[model samples]
Target: MSAPIPNRVHYHKRDRELELGYPDGESYRLPIELLRVYSPSAEVQGHHPSEAVLQTGKRNVGLLNITQTGRYALKLHFDDGHDTGLYTWEYLHDMATHQQAWWENYLTRLERAGASRDSGVIQIHQV
Candidate 1:
């Protein structure tokens, strides 16, 4: 079966979801943080399975920009300075379908590595 093509794409800043509407009356709301963690770039996915990097501390990440790349994909520029992942239609569909499982796996990995979703360090200034 062929992957469904997206008819409309809407990024909700407040909700932090990239909503994709398909012709088959289905819509997927992909969270910005999940998209950032599951980025398909070499920096995240790596060249080999063994070299894949586990993305941590991105619970509060947001989308900075989204640019269409040709007719097949969109380049997502994240607020955390990551702008390399080209999210293809098929890739998005796959991610949307298996989001729950993948997210659970990510949480497990984080727990094992003692990583926090809050990647940013805030400096407190006392007057």
Candidate 2:
């Protein structure tokens, strides 16, 4: 089944989230921090899953802009200068639907790497 396309999109500056409204009356608020850390850009996701980079110090990152990419995706602009990710409709819907589980997994990964969400506070892991 195809994912639902959002009919409305709004970025909440104060809350630092992107709110997506669907035609079926379901809505989701996706955090800016979550979007940044899970960005689908090659720089973040890498060429392979095992090569994916761990994003840290992104709690203060801002969502600068959101633009359409030929109706299939959205180009997300970030204040941290990351603007390569293309968030497709299907990806967005899936992300919003499974955000809780994905977020917990992100936290687990961060903990395993001794990473911090706050800026400039990285813990060096001796390997």
**lDDT at position 95, candidate 1:** 89
Candidate 1 TM-score to native: 0.90
Candidate whose lDDT is highest: 2
lDDT of 2 by residue, 14-101 (tens): 8999999999999999999999999999999999999899999998888888999997888999999999999999999999999999
Could you give candidate 1's per-residue lDDT for residues 1-127 as a string of tens digits?
7578799988999998999999988999999999999899999999998988988889888888898999889899999999998999899999889989878988998777767777764434458
Top-TM-score candidate index: 2
TM-score, each model? 0.90, 0.94
What's the true lDDT of residue 74 in model 1? 85
Question: Each candidate's lDDT (Cα)?
Answer: 0.89, 0.93
RMSD of each: 4.9, 2.0
Looking at model 1, residue 86 earns an lDDT score of: 92
| Count of clashing residue pairs in every prediction | 1, 0
